[model samples]
Target: MKALKKIATSLIILALAAVPAFAGQQGESSGILTWLFLGFIGLIVVGQLIPALVMGFGMVKGVLGHSDDHSHKHNA
Candidate 1:
């Protein structure tokens, strides 16, 4: 009985691990969740990636220096 229980447990683990190996073998589309996840990742890439790249380039170019753009006014 103990050996049978150990074999059953090992079979269950093996089956769980093998699940992804046979994934998409059936002719079925990946459905809406995949597209929705991709869309979410796309939005994040657009919102964060572009600005980060631009800011990095600007930093390398020294475009963030605080220059005196306003004239100083003297008051008594």
Candidate 2:
């Protein structure tokens, strides 16, 4: 009947769609040296970031203090 035709067509489509999944090959992993190099790079980045943040915060504090120093107009 008409319903049977539609069911057969859907099953054919589903089977074709699943072919790629069955064809996939497993990948090999990079080993420990890759991890060690990545860790070393991460450390270098973090080390640079800490001093940059401290200097940024110090600049912000200095700017805010300059604004507060406005009350010392009489000192001029």
lDDT of 2 by residue, 1-76 (tens): 5986899899999999999996776787769999999999999999999999799879988877745445555655
The residue-level lDDT of candidate 2 at 40 comes to 99
Q: What's each prediction's TM-score?
A: 0.42, 0.52
Task: Give one clash count per candidate, in the order shown.
Answer: 0, 0
Report the CA-based lDDT of candidate 1 relative to the real structure.
Answer: 0.86
Instruction: Please write out the lDDT profile of model 1 over residues 1-76, one tens digit for every residue.
Output: 5986899899999999999988858786888999999999999889997899788878966776777667878798
* Model 1 stretches with alpha carbons more than 4 Å out: 1-27, 63-76
